[model samples]
Target chain A: GAGVSQTPSNKVTEKGKYVELRCDPISGHTALYWYRQSLGQGPEFLIYFQGTGAADDSGLPNDRFFAVRPEGSVSTLKIQRTERGDSAVYLCASSPDRVNEQFFGPGTRLTVL
Target chain B: AQSVTQLDSHVSVSEGTPVLLRCNYSSSYSPSLFWYVQHPNKGLQLLLKYTSAATLVKGINGFEAEFKKSETSFHLTKPSAHMSDAAEYFCVVRLERGGNQFYFGTGTSLTVIP
Candidate 1:
C-alpha cells in the first residue's frame, strides 16, 4: 500500500518569493493535517482538513500561510512572500478520522534564502 | 488548553539497559495520548496511543506507555534499549473538546550507546 506522500522532498527559494507544497494522503483517509517542525523542535500544527472542508486552521502562523484540499484527497500549502524564518520541514499526515491515530509522510524541507 | 511537557531534552543509555522517557500532560478532560518516533530524514511514526482504554498501553518495537490520570502523565518506557532505538521521540496530546487538534511536546532525543 502507498503511504502518505509529499512531492518535492526539498525546495529552496529566495525570500519574498511564493512557494507551494503538495501532499497526497493515504487512500481512503479522510483527515489530512499539516505541521511544521523547526530544528530541535517538535512538529507544530498548522492546518487540518476533514473531507473537502478545513475542519480547523487556527494553527496557521499568519495570513501569508494558506492551505486547501479541494478534492478531499490531495492538499496544497501555499506561502506568500516567503521569509527565511519559514525554513523548516513541512510534514503532512492523515488519519481515518479525527480521533484516529495519524500516519505521517516524509516532509518537504523548505529552505528560504 | 491542552499541552505536553517532555522533561528531558536528551537521554543517553547503553544497549541492553532500561530506557525511560518522562512526559507529563495537562488536559481539561480525559485526553488521548500518543508517542511518536522519528528517525533522521524520516517521517514521524506512531509508536502507540491511549484513548480511555486501559491504563497501560503497549506499542510497537517493544515500547509501552502507562497513562496516569492522577498524575496527568503518559511516559514511555522500554525494558532494554537497542541501537536502533536512537531517535527523536515526541509525546502528543489530543483534547476531547477541541477540534481534533493535537499538541506536541518539545521532543526528547534518545542516544543509544553500544
Candidate 2:
C-alpha cells in the first residue's frame, strides 16, 4: 500500500551548491528517518522525526545538513554548500511506530562534483 | 553505543547450496535485531526481525535468522541458495532507548552462481 518513496532518483550538482531531497512516508507512519549510504557501505543514520517535530538529529554529520517534516507526512532533507564528500545515496525510511521495523525508500542518489 | 558487525564482506555460493551470512552486534540494552536485503536499484527490504519474541525468525523468500544472545550474534541462513538471492545484506541493531535509532553494519554482498 504505497511504501516509502523518495523523489529525484538521481541528482548531480557542483560543490558549494544546495540540494534538497524529498521523501513521502507510508500512510499512518508516525516515525520517519533519514540515512546516508556511501559507496560499498551501509546506511548511516542522519535524523529521525516523530510526527512533525524531529525527535533526534544527532546523527546529522554537520550543521550544513538539516531536515524537516512539516504536517507529519512529507519530509525534506536539505544540504547547504554541498561537498564532494556528500556524494552518496540518501535513504528515507518510515515505520508505524518507533518499535516496529522500518520500510525504506529507493533512495535519492546525490553526486557533488 | 549500539553497533552491528557483519562478519563477511562478500559471500559466494553455487545455486542449490546452503547459504549463511554472519552478523554480531553490541548494545547496552536489550536490542531489536533485523536483517535487510538490498537488490540493485531497489529499496532495502526487511528479511526478518528479532524483537525478543523467539530465537528463530523466518522471513520472506525462504530466508531465516537466529538470534543468539549468549554469542551476541544473529546469523542469516537459507537451506538452498537461489540465484535471486544475490544481493547486499545488512544487519541492523536498534536500541530500545535513545530514540530507537537503528545502527547498521557494513553490508555483505552475496553472489549466487548457477
Candidate 1 has what TM-score? 0.98
> Which regions of candidate 1 deviate over 4 angstroms?
none
Q: Please tell me what DockQ candidate 1 reaches.
A: 0.91
Estimate, for each residue in B1-114, the C-alpha lDDT of model 1 and write its tens digit.
448999999999999999999999988888999999999988899999999999999999999999999999899999999999999999999888658789999999999999
Clash-forming residue pairs, model 1: none
Q: How good is chain A of candidate 2, measured by TM-score? A: 0.99
Clashing pairs in 2: none
lDDT by residue (tens digit), candidate 1, A1-113 = 99999989999999999999999999999999999999999999999999999999999999999999999999999999999999999999999999889999999999999
For model 2, the stretches where C-alpha displacement exceeds 4 angstroms are: none
Single-chain TM-score of chain A, each candidate: 0.99, 0.99
TM-score, chain B, model 1, is 0.97
